[model samples]
Target: MDLFADDTRLTPMPIDDGELWFQQRLPLDLAPDEVMRRLLAETGWREEEIQVWGKLHKQPRLSAWHGEASYRYSGKTFHPQPFTALQLHIKQTVERVTGRRFNSVLLNYYRDERDSMGFHADDERELGPEPAIASVSFGAPRTFILKHRHLPKKVQLALGDGCLLLMAGALQKHWLHGINKERTPRGPRINLTFRLIL
Candidate 1:
């Protein structure tokens, strides 16, 4: 399961501030379509209502939490559900590539072009300092954006299906990342962000 031990496809994302590794397509035997279908059918996806500026609004996408501990964000607490077999397998694969152990994963389902995530840092207290996040994508491709905390520079990446993006070191501390809503029509997509829940 050592994905980078012999592979030459692993490439570091060209960023000036933080550590990021990007693989256009992970070297895995599982089919992206199959994985997407299974996750859609099996995951208990829910549209959570989050409070922003004292106003309650439904999250644009469906999401589920799986792991060994609870995750708190946006003034809400999410308890972990038992990891599905497919999820555990994928987690192990990502861990092998990133060299990081994750006890929890946040699954986000973007049903269409309108579903999106706003810019934010994954600097929750429970994640501790300098957390490593391994993100895997399936299904349709989407644009992932990263902006510096204080500067005007930004990084834009097209995260393809079956691709893996690893963010470690001071990435979260110095940059904010998010996926904006696409204006053009697009198919559904699933994103799995594996993290260590301390």
Candidate 2:
């Protein structure tokens, strides 16, 4: 993929010794609020009502592969839900950024202070070995942290409004990222992580 073209108005944020880069607060071609409203109306984000691994999991969740019933996690099976058009649209924009295609997207809606995802790597068996995951943040600003699996330093990025965070090359193999829970009041945030499932 072309690293940076004249048409692409994204500035790369550097990282330590790894291939992780992000363009913070870059303006998207679409209006942020309009896109958010369209996504909320189109995407059927259901309030999840389940308890798994002693943690509360929500609905409107789909796996990397479509039409799959069991999303294997720690030797257990979990069902998947359907995806919305907004998910597909975000994926396409991410593809344009990286000049690579992605087949699936994992959408997480942080409703409030209580909703959060645990720390984990995107090391799924289907995502190949060195996957490129393009994460686009919409709506509210949130702090996304990454702790090196083998290094000493930890990185943090305030993913505000409309921004694109791309984790490419060998990032997933060496780093684990997550969104930490904050105490302050915040609006709903929808994150679309674009991944290519092999």
Candidate 3:
């Protein structure tokens, strides 16, 4: 983990395919613990607290995005949850490192060993084609899996606390990714995925 660095540029994906570029690393100013605490306190999100689905309409999981009423599911709409100072700091750092401005972000809080996101692409219409997604992970380390859409190759990365991952280009078109909830003891994790919504 590149902890305590202000920001670091990452290796860009090879470009035989069209549409995608990215960078990943921990934000320079905040420590891992500080990021976690502020996220929990500001969101008023208790560990394992499940909110109504905000984006993915077809899934049995907890999710939140944009705080838009139209984006809500399960009878509860969130009014654009304000970003904490830590969130803004990280976002700025990401923008600097990736050289891309992100208008909106989607926050996914995975509590303990049960909360998990199923396989899917970040290919929403608002994301536009060849979307650039910069993901910053805090708290417990989790396995992020990527599988080819037509090919059989699968890749996995252990996202340690304060690790940053970037997915860009046609990676979304040719691949799908997700966090699986099997049977392993884990701590709370806050994932901030910065995106550009058209």
As for lDDT, the candidate ahead, 1 or 3, is 1
Pairs that clash in candidate 3: 5-28, 6-28, 19-169, 20-168, 20-169, 67-80
**TM-scores of the candidates in the order shown:** 0.94, 0.78, 0.77
Off by over 4 Å in 3: 1-9, 13-24, 44-62, 66-79
Error of 2 at 2 (Å): 26
TM-score of 2: 0.78
For all candidates, the clash counts are 0, 1, 6
Evaluate model 2: give its lDDT: 0.67
- Assess each prediction's global lDDT (C-alpha) against the native: 0.88, 0.67, 0.67
**Model 2 lDDT tens row, 16-115:** 5457666654345678887777766766555544566776655333223222233444444434455555565666666676677876666677877666
List runs of model 2 lying over 4 Å from the truth. Answer: 1-8, 25-28, 47-83
- Better candidate by lDDT, 1 or 2: 1
What tens digits encode model 3's per-residue C-alpha lDDT throughout 1-198?
Answer: 122222355654443343333334564687888888887777654222334454434333334564222332234433456555666788888888777888666778887767788787877655677888888888898888777788776766677787777788777788888989959899889888887766
lDDT of 2 at 84: 59
For residue 63, give model 1's deviation from the true position in Å. 0.4
Clashes counted in candidate 3 amount to: 6
By descending TM-score, how would the candidates be arranged?
A: 1, 2, 3
